[model samples]
Target: MSIIRSERRNRYTTISNTVFTNNQLSFQAMGMLSYILSKPDNWSVSPAQLITVTKNTAKKTARDGVYAILKELKDTGFVGIEKLSTGDTNYIVYDTPIAKKPNPYNTDMGDPNTAKPDPYKPDPSEPTLIKTDIKQELKSNNKDLLSSKHDDTNPSDKNSDSAKQVIQHLNAVTGSKFQCCKSNINHINGRLNDGYTVEDLCLVITQKQIEWGSDGKMAQYIRPSTLFKASKFSGYLQAAKITKLNPDNRPVTLADFDDLTWGKDLGL
Candidate 1:
């Protein structure tokens, strides 16, 4: 239920441009894009879920058609695809501008039905030139500026390390191995930003492990995606507190009864 806010202006521009100018996308692709944009931000949906939700509305029945649309969106930079550890794909559609190559054929000075410009034809206008050193300096300055912007947007090393620590703690407490990947770190950081402390997260993990560790059926469900989710973290914290006060016998081991023997040792 983690929702990322979508930019209204960017969404409108992307949809409008795709419908009116792109002319390459099919009706199915356009419909799929529209459907994805209509979803809440940061909403992760598998391909099967997407097909089920969009098939009726898009009037497309084939799963392959839906997959083709998704692939097109990914290739065209309209959406991002994250493959989860569970062998399912998560699609993230953003309201950002997609990069496109400049079309020399679609120029303001040309008619749609007219032929393309001749390579040998000389233009009547005079050409203006810039000095080489100034151009090089400008290019270097632009590169430096872009680098700074990229650094500002990327997650810092401290945040990444903190996320890794959380993953390690979970692995230790639950006796399960989980790697710290970008998607996992992103989820953990997002929960942290939402006011959940690292202590609260670890408490939840330990509590769940104690409760479900002994049960073979529930042990498989102990994963980062389930225990560290944004929407469910608060609930888990509350449950953990309740379980702590009552104390479940499921966590008990044979070591707890090593002192006890037969009736003779029990003062019989």
Candidate 2:
């Protein structure tokens, strides 16, 4: 069956809290649920289709990995799988409730068995309306104000928060006395906005600290100003990954560090 697009404009899916709380579920399983929920309700999908979609979105692309995630999602009651009458075809179906268009005239009045009220009948108990337009305008303005206050964070604030987190992680890992400064914050925020996650930054820092913590020449360069500079931050990320894969191996020469601009070349 074809998927239906309703009135929702954001184009997002809902993931319930239980999915996170379930110890049996992994991150891959949660991602699969999100993909399923994004489709229209009652839509049928096969195990092969799920595996393909999961492979595209997640890092764990093994067939057994996909099967394990699907099994977990199924066992948790997040999705249902059924075998058709043909007995050869199996379809996985999302079990969540779907949204239906609201009707103004057909009010259920909280009881499904209740009879519909006459539209022609005027109720005298209804409250009298006065200055409704002005009241509605005021309410709308208040709502807009509240939305502005709560919905979005200032870009500067986001940058500062991300920078602070990076700095905190660095201090914890390197045993350094580095404080947040305008220059380092801008550099850290720039890398973060370039699509590197906070965890990625921390991993880079942790790997570098382990590599350079003892060397007097390199230890001095572990400060925020030297490591987090925009021109060299990407190189440090690559270097960290290299170090993680080969902890004991070191670059052959100092020139090797100069050629470590892989992150810069990728525009990371």
**148-226 per-residue lDDT for model 2 (tens digits):** 2222334556666656666755653454546666666666777788888765666566556555654547867776777
| Tens digit per residue, CA lDDT, model 1, 154-231 | 356556555655665565344344666666667788877888776666667656765665455886767777788877
Minimal lDDT window, size 10, model 2? 251-260
Runs with alpha carbons beyond 4 Å of true place in candidate 2: 1-156, 246-268
> TM-score of each candidate?
0.34, 0.33
Identify the runs in model 1 with alpha carbons over 4 angstroms from their true place. 1-158, 246-268
